[model samples]
Target: MSLGAERRHIRDVTAWQPRVPGVVEVFHAHYTEYAYPMHVHDAWTLLVVDDGAVRYDLDRHEHGTPHGTVTLLPPHVPHNGEPVTEAGFRKRVLYLEPGALDTSLIGAAVDEPDLRDPLLRRRVGQLHTALAHPGDELEAESRLVLVRERLRHHLRPRPVRQPHPDERPLARRLRELLDERTAQGVTLGEAAALVHAHPAHLVRAFSTAFGIAPHQYLMSRRVEHARRLLLAGQPPGEVAALSGFYDQAHLTRHFKRWVGVPPGRYARTSASLT
Candidate 1:
């Protein structure tokens, strides 16, 4: 088999680790002829092909990326990818932490790695978009929660369990924790552990009690903190660090969404008033 042409045309490949919880890595690739060798990953592989298609073998069974589908390759499973056409393929992948999905579901994933669900495909696409932008961690995290839920739904269908009796207390505790760590913030997993609840349940409790998602609530609080810092004349970049944002862009995005102007302009205008 000729590998030279394929090797030379392997052009686009990008990978990074975002700060969002439950995600280990994000990768995007475009290739016309490149093929992936049989390999195993320690994390769960959630993949979607944006253009073209991919043919792969998981656990000795052949699989392909059909149009409007999401593929979930379980951890420790061996897989390989090949181009399905002369046009090659473009794909975005999320490597989820092992804990993101239960290990027992590995069997189900290996049995049916390719899922034909339009909602899952769309949600995965939205997740990739969120991951690509630096200031969109909150959005990314929120989308990830939904994506995980959808994946779990496919791998193992379960009945909806009723909320526990202490749901209100759990929400109140989460709110208090958020108040105490507004500047620092907290991951849903960490908050759940501290509050003695499951991560999904914790999100439900908080949102039900406050009518806002945890990430949205946190971003709003950070924006409020940034406002105070801007009024005190702190630079936007510096205020971002003090306000618990990933960077100035992150701070500015939320600040403008919550406030009416950018941090610099807001600071200047407030100074004029004083």
Candidate 2:
């Protein structure tokens, strides 16, 4: 319901713990004049303002996440949410576990927090509704996957890197470097310096030699490592560190992109299949 320009009589806060394995907390709140003071969370704060409009600030930058925008705040990032209109706003929030998502997805949100995608908004509702039910975990997880995928689409940049057929040698050296230092992220310049090539040239050459960018190949290796860890029953947080991902959320983003699903879900499905 659109709270619109008129203040409604709704003033309530309903919060609970989702019975789902990875979710931390779920909350629904309606406000008219409430302005939250700047705060920080230890988990990824996912919010969907259903009606009217809500505004928030992350790392000193303000954002408006109304009906269509999804508010994504990475862990430890300070933020505040308040109503935008006199009628205030209504919001559904999910405070995900620190290890709930891949650290890279959260990084994407950190770079572009206000995800203004219509499909993502709908998927959020679907995921939330599924989460509201306690026993339909399969459905909830299914919806969560789609929601995350859509969010990732908005958060990640897809640049086409064309390869130079003759530069495979340089690209090969960069690939070796990436394999050697999977945990420590290598910059384009670093890869270039290692092979005595310009950054752009090295990128093209790497793509030519491996059919994927230097970063992509490295990430694929990391994803494979994370997958093994998951299959071994290691948690996402530990898997993230072990797989050379910066964090669980970062691992999630890359894992989903490479493996077609999040690590937790992959592990569960693999276990069931096994």
Top-TM-score candidate index: 1
**Candidate 1 residues 43-68, lDDT tens each?**
78898898999999875679999888
TM of each candidate vs. truth: 0.55, 0.53
**Residue 198 C-alpha lDDT in model 2:** 88
- How many times do residue backbones clash in model 2? 10
Worst 10 residues of 1 by lDDT: 157-166
Q: How many angstroms is residue 12 displaced in model 2 relative to the true structure, after the best TM-score fit?
A: 1.2
The stretch of ten residues in a row with the least summed lDDT in candidate 2 is 156-165
In model 1, what are the clashing residue pairs, if there are any?
Answer: none
Error of 2 at 249 (Å): 36
Error of 1 at 100 (Å): 0.4
Best by lDDT: 1
